[model samples]
Target: MIKNYIKLALKLMLRKKYYTALTLVGISFTIMIITVFASFVDQIIGANTPERNRSRMLLLDKVSIYRNGKSTDATPSVHFLQHLPKLESAETVSILKRNEFVSFLNGKTAGHVLQQTDENLWNIADFKFVEGKSYTTDDVKSGARVAVINEKTKEHFFNNEDAEGKSITIYGQAFKVIGVLKSAAAFSKLYGDVYVPYTTDMNLHTTEKAIEGTYSAIILSKSEDARKVRTELRSQMRKIGRNANGADSLKLYPFSSIEQFAKSSSSNDDEPEYGKTTIILLIVMVLFMLIPAISLINLNLSRIGERAEEIGVRKSFGATSGALVKQFIIENVIITLIGGLIGLGMSIYASKLLIQVINSFDPLFKMPTDTFIVSWPVFAFCLFSCLIFGLVSGAYPAWKMSRMNVIYALKGGNSL
Candidate 1:
């Protein structure tokens, strides 16, 4: 029975080739756009590579002080790090300070992200090593000037030469390149072209205030432990706020890997409304899908109207309304499924194109990956969306066909 429905659906599709092509293009194009956009979003927020442990990570990246109705914001302080309460839930913790370093090598000038971080940053945020190894805890404690350079930096400075044991000159300071890493995603907390011990940079470790300075902290733990960890960190931060001399109101901002990016674009600097941001994103995607589905419905209505005579003939031959509806829905689903496959292929190609276009702009924008990998879950969700798309657009037209007067339908009219 299903085979017959598919055979008829294919025959009808070929009968009106241009309309079939138009419908497929509409569905395919919408799927391609949404898939590619979602893929990039997953790359940024979802656990991809070095950020694989993101689901279990918490970051206290910012702090704010309210003074006399004015707001002063800064990175979480070294002082806060120095006095952090024991995070019993944490698997690993890191103290990180970010700055830019300029390098002039082989008459080429480039700026690189210089992350002054403790060795624990290596533990909390996974960095895939191309060669050599990350600086050890002993290296950080002794203020070793060893550096870990990313693959892009390796390309820029060495030009395909082996980087380990080589010396890289950054900001007129010579640091030995002890490790080379695959470039992490640009938006990740671990994002940097060069990583070195914070102990090596006196400016980063020097505490300017008890609650405000240029540093941040990340804690990684079991997924179930995140809430407990955040609660403990907040309590500790509040204690510091109460104990500090001449302290106004001190507030710590805690965020997950995804929430950090979501909240970053808020107009308010004090506290972010990320729930609204999430809702807005969901609505935008829904609207995009809805427009294409609406077009499909209108197109289906026109095509079904042309099949009024067929519907009347089938009804005359004792076809039940339920069976007719089922057949039409099956036909729509088949077309949508075909369009989904085309969309899947197009999305993969478009993702690679997008990556190339982004990297074409500048060296500083270079990320690790060349291919945009659409995760299985993402594609699966899209597949389910296609099924829903098929049923919804098919239903109304099929119902309308079932309601038509048998005599009018025989005369090729839609009168009910």
Candidate 2:
């Protein structure tokens, strides 16, 4: 029965060539827009390179402090770093600093985003290395000027040649590139074109403690431990993380990858708006599909009208309304699946092209790396969404038209 439904669906679709073309095009355009947007959001919130421990990790990126009525906002400081509350579930914690480094490349100035880190970062992040290895504990302890660079940095400066074991000059200091990373996801605490040891930055070696600095932290823990971690962090900070240099107030929040993106722009003084962000995304997706869904419903009704005589004949032969509804929904599903596949293919292609284009202007504006992964779960999500559109648009109209009296339908009276 299902096989017959598919054949009939295809026949009906081909019979109205223009209508099928228009419906497929509309669905493809709508799904394409949704997929592109969702893919980018996925890059920020989904598991990716370096931060593959996304669900098991929390990032502390920004801090807010108030002292003598002066408000300052920046990355967490050495003071907060030193006083960081011990998270009971923490497996490892890493401290990182980001800086813009200017280097002379082919007699022209090139800027790179650099990450300075302790050895712990390497433990939490599994950076894919194309050449050499990451810095060791000894190198960071001895303040060795060693660096790890991304492929884009390698290509920009060394013309895609071997970068490991070669010195790259930044701010009159030559740091030997120790490792070369494959393409990595950007726009995170771990994001950078070049990476080096934090000990080499002598400015951070200051004996005096401060409230704000260019330092951020990432803590790896069990997925279920996030609530406890956040709760303890708030409690511990209020008790001991303050009172530095007369700054009686300080604010910071720890977030998972998805929460981090959602709360990226919210004020640190309050709890992150996780619920609000989720609601907004749901609303946006519903609104985006609303128009396409209405069009599909109307199109289904029109198609039913054109086949009123056929429906009447089938009804007279004792065809059940349920059977007719199921058949129409199946037909709708087939059409929606085709549109979905086309949209997804276009999204994957666009993402690849965008990656190449984004690399040319990277560190200035970092694009999410390697978006639109074709995993079973992702594909299933697309399929499920397609099914929803198919059922919603086709089921009711199919049922109503299928239930029309044989006499009324045969007379070409389309009143539903």
lDDT of 2 by residue, 1-416 (tens): 99999998899789989988998888877777777667667667777667778877887877767767787877877556857767776787888888887776677666788888888888998788998999998998899999999887888779989988898876678899999987566555577888899888767857437767778888787555576677767676677634555677766667788767667656643556677788888888887777898999987887667778877888788889888888778988898888878877876776666666876766454444563354455556666777787777788778878787778778776655
Clash number by candidate, in order: 0, 0
Candidate 1 error regions (>4 Å)? 66-71, 107-109, 205-210, 222-225, 261-275, 355-364, 368-372
Q: Write the per-residue lDDT of candidate 1 for residues 1-416, one digit (tens) a residue.
A: 88999999999889989989998999899888878877777877788767888878778787666666676777777766766777777777788888897776678778788998888888777778998999998998898989999988899889969999999876677899999998876656678999998888867546655567778888786564456776676676677664553555667666676666676767664345678778877887788688999999999888766999999999999988999899999999989888987998899888877777776787654554543578787798778878887898898888888887888999999887
Q: Estimate every model's Cα lDDT from 0 to 1.
A: 0.80, 0.76
Instruction: Provide the TM-score for each candidate, comma-separated.
Output: 0.87, 0.89
Q: Worst lDDT window (10 residues) for model 1? A: 363-372
Model 1 deviation from native, Cα RMSD in Å: 3.0
Error of 2 at 136 (Å): 1.5
Top-scoring candidate (TM-score): 2
In the order shown, what is each candidate's alpha-carbon RMSD?
A: 3.0, 3.0
- Model 2 misplaced stretches (Cα beyond 4 Å): 66-72, 83-85, 107-110, 205-208, 241-243, 262-269, 352-376, 411-416
